[model samples]
Target: MAKKQTKDQALANNRRASFNYLIGETYEAGIQLTGTEIKSVRLGQITIGDAYVTIRNGQAYLNNANISPYKQGNQFNSDPLRRRKLLLHKREIAALDEAVMQGGKTIVPLRVYLVKGFAKILIAIGTGKKNYDKRQTIKERDMQRELGKNLKNYH
Candidate 1:
């Protein structure tokens, strides 16, 4: 039997999001991009490290996600740091807005990928970790690394 292939192709990842926040529910969102932006994205010239999601006037926008200008797109390139609309359902946007209004919850983009030739981003609800929580996370990571090494040596 032949194995099925996954159509989603990852373009960019926000590795720090996991380390900096306690992630909760996740959502898949579509990004509204211009011609040059899509071209840049196809070439993997995108960064979401400093990107975040915000809802305003019943709409969700992706802010601070940087997409480098296409080399051949002179006079047609959009601003790299301009906020882009996130194509989500009204109910989803309302839910996210509600979640964000509570305590320290926030919406953060985790990764950008392509699905069926269309760009998609994975976003999640997260709470900012305290300094002590960050330290604990680091310690746990170190312990896991050490344990993996010990297991390898034992085997």
Candidate 2:
């Protein structure tokens, strides 16, 4: 059997998303990309840090995601920052739209990875975290690190 890959081996991850937003439900969506875009992604030249998802006309689109042009793609390369369409079911789109409209939630890209040789994106609904919430997160993380260090020393 082949070894299974984990989500941490993603091509690109928005590390700040967790600190800045209280992430809710997450969904895996397929991305429509061109040949050169996929080449760039395979090279690990993508950034989802500032990418966001928006639903329009019942379709979800990824915006502001930067996939650097392939070095050897020449004229075949498309715009690096072009908006890419997300492939999601009609029911998923409807639910996401409703959540955004009624729950005041935002959709953000969490990570991008290749699954079964296809490019996929992980997106999540999130509520923006306040300044104090961010501080608390930092404090908790620090405490966890300290506790781990002490435990390691005792062991």
Candidate 3:
């Protein structure tokens, strides 16, 4: 039998999530995807930059995530921006709901990756940062870069 190759890597990343919000705790959850959607995702044609998690009727759903239709899916392709259900434990869902309602935190998708031929998403609880906080982060990053360069010159 031929050995099957497994590609364990992130298909899409929300790089702006860190810059825009202070992420607290993270949870890994499985995503329910259609046939065409999964095929498109495997081809690296998904975007989660503006995606967020919301709880409805005790179930968690991913909103605003775009998974482009598979090129060869023909008429079986689903809507690109359709809300997808997230597979998380009941306890986890309750915890996230409590955090959002009481703690004033938001759920954001950090990244989407493939593990063991299944799609998984890393979700986090985050609080939005103020304008000054963003500026401070940029300033600190620049300073760190400069310091690293200065230290390299001394070696």
Candidate 4:
């Protein structure tokens, strides 16, 4: 018999975010999406690789996140690259705003997933990584992969 799978699952992940930045604190923010957009998300038609979070007018906005147009949406589908609003508390927005103001720090989306039928994004404070830092990340990742392979062979 097949077991029922959990409805909560990741729709998109920013794999490059970790390689490109030094991540700090993280927060979960709700995303405001249209009906078609939500439909596309549930189908895993989303990309958040180059997406980032920004604060303006005391509100947080998600930029560069692409939610592809639904196949049957036709004219009902909105722009795939349109800026989406992120729902967060005033204090949370203020904290993110303050972190950005500290200079050299920015907010980036780590991943997007569904929670109770609603889309939620995991955002974090990040500082840009230097070229050398990126190289170190690559080295560490390779080492981890090699170690995992060795352990499997040992077993």
Candidate 5:
């Protein structure tokens, strides 16, 4: 018998947010999604390019994360742009709430994936980076790539 690979069902991801922000803290929270929504996520039908995390009334929410409706599911499909609630413990929410109070700091979802059959999101407590900081990051990335290329060629 052949063993099957265990692959996660990724719902969404915000790639560039990390590049533009300095990450301070991270929290993993479960997402409340419907049945068809879960199916769509398993099919990788989602986008988080412009998504953000928001806290209101002591609860965290995923805003602007587009989860495409399941093709075969009708009348049971969830809205693609609907705000989804994130399930986190009270302590985590309070900590995030305090961190968000800092200037220019906010909660941002970095990744959304499935674990143990449940949709989990990795949210970051982050502060925005300045223009000079972005430039420096670009320079550092270029330098690292060049170094790797040179080492490979030399070997």
Candidate 6:
């Protein structure tokens, strides 16, 4: 028997989004990819550093995401930077629309990955953290790290 191969090949992740926002809930959404776009993504040549999600007309879409064109795609290459539509359920889109309508809440793309040979995007409903809130999170993380170190020393 042959080993089954997995289509992981994570294109990109927005690590800073976690620190800057209080993520309330996460949802997985499918992205509409062109032929060249999928090829470029599979090659792990994409970036989501400045990507964000927005709910408009009961649909969620990605903005400011960049997927590098395939090297040999030639005339068939896709736009390196373009707005891509994200597929989500109707109820999910309504919920996202409501959350984003709140004062400081936003929809942000956390990471882009492939699953079962299909591309998937993880979206988070987040609230922008104030400066003090960010500092508190940092302090808590530091404390947790210190506690782990102390526990290891005791053992």
Q: Which segments of candidate 1 are over 4 A away from where they belong?
A: 1-8
1-155 per-residue lDDT for model 4 (tens digits):
63322434678989899989999999999999999999998888999998998899999999999999999999999999999999999999999999999999999899888877788899999999999999999999999999999999999
Deviation in angstroms for 54 in model 3?
A: 0.6
Give the best candidate by TM-score.
2
* Candidate 2 residue-wise lDDT at 119: 91
lDDT of each: 0.93, 0.92, 0.93, 0.92, 0.85, 0.86
What is the RMSD, in Å, between candidate 2 and the native fold over all Cα? Answer: 2.2
Clashing pairs in 5: none
| TM-score, prediction 5 | 0.92
- List RMSD in Å for every model shown: 3.2, 2.2, 2.3, 2.3, 2.4, 2.6
TM-score per model over all chains: 0.93, 0.93, 0.92, 0.92, 0.92, 0.86
- Candidate 4 residues lying further than 4 Å off, grouped into runs, are 1-8
Lowest lDDT 10-mer window, candidate 6? 1-10
Write one digit per residue (lDDT tens) for candidate 5, span 1-155: 63222334356768898788998889999889999998887777878887888889999999999999899999999789999999999989989988888668988888778776677888898899999999999999999999999999998
Across residues 1-155, which tens digit of lDDT does each residue of candidate 1 receive?
63322335578999999999999999999999999999898888999999999999999999999999999999999999999999999999989999999979999999998876678999999999999999999999999999999999998
**Order of quality (TM-score):** 2, 1, 4, 3, 5, 6
Residue clash pairs of candidate 6: none
Q: Which stretches of candidate 5 lie over 4 Å from their true place?
A: 1-11
Q: What overall lDDT, based on C-alpha atoms, would model 6 receive against the true structure?
A: 0.86
